[model samples]
Target: MSHKEALPKAAFQYGVKMADGRKTRRTGVGKRDDKAKLDRELQKINQIIARRKAEAADGGGVGTPDYKRPRY
Candidate 1:
């Protein structure tokens, strides 16, 4: 039988119980949303930082690297 067709009924029963609980963590509802949003923003900032670092590495003028002096 397929794995999808072999799931235990106890799992479904637990899911029902978890859904019925107002503060059940098993459902993972509305948990850490702010942290997730912050992570997304951090990822964006890191992407921008990487782009700037690459531009600096190619001898283009955006800003001086932390370990280098300004030659201009």
Candidate 2:
């Protein structure tokens, strides 16, 4: 394949954050009833969900912070 064809076309994807308060993606606490930190982190995750909903409603969606548009 040509170099231009092999290059990535876009660098960002729009989506909600699904990581836990541990700040790791696709992970969650093992037990639900025995940790204060888990409770706090779950609350924080809920806050993030609410914020993302608000952004979607307002059409404030974006992909990435450092992506520069291709010059035409």
Candidate 3:
């Protein structure tokens, strides 16, 4: 009979337990992708905050109401 090669193990393995008693798996995949995605999200949030601050400084913020309009 011909010899067979051993199968490789799984890329991910059981890691740790969660606070709710659930099991978790740890993997080395997609870490860089996740970091890139988080960085992009943070950049977008920062840009929006900066734009809002600039608008507030220019007195054109949404919180500023038109004084010419009569209040009900």
Candidate 4:
């Protein structure tokens, strides 16, 4: 299933940790938008995600990996 068709909300969040000990986050909302509008928002989110992925791959601002603690 396509993302837009599967997920009701188009908004998404992304975060990056700077090498200098700071964290940055990106988020958005299109809660009241119709399907077409939501699709556009999703496309925007996808594009931003792609760009961030490229930047991370290039080792731009992505610092050390963040490991998650295991649950008991």
Q: How many backbone clashes does candidate 2 have?
A: 0
What TM-score do all the candidates reach, one by one?
0.43, 0.37, 0.46, 0.37
- For model 1, where is the 10-residue window of minimal lDDT? 22-31
Name the candidate that leads on TM-score. Answer: 3
What are the lDDT scores of the predictions, listed in order? Answer: 0.73, 0.55, 0.63, 0.55
Q: Summarize candidate 1's per-residue lDDT along 1-72 as a digit string, tens digits.
A: 555666689998888887888455544545677779889999999988887777678876547665685432
Residue ranges of candidate 4 with Cα displaced over 4 Å: 1-33, 61-72
For residues 1-72, write the lDDT of model 4, one tens digit per residue: 556555333332222234444545323433534767878989999988888677668875455444532111
Task: Write model 3 residue lDDT over 41-64, tens digit each, in one string.
Answer: 999999888876776687764565
Per-residue accuracy of model 2 over 1-72 as CA lDDT, tens digit each: 555545343421212232323345444554544587678989999988888677668765366343452211
Relative to the true structure, candidate 2 has a C-alpha RMSD (angstroms) of: 25.8
Clashing pairs in 1: none
- Enumerate residue pairs that collide in model 4: none
lDDT, residue 33, model 3:
81
Give the worst 10-residue stretch by lDDT in candidate 3.
10-19
The list of candidate 1 runs beyond 4 A from truth reads: 1-31, 61-72
Misplaced by over 4 Å in model 2 are: 1-34, 61-72
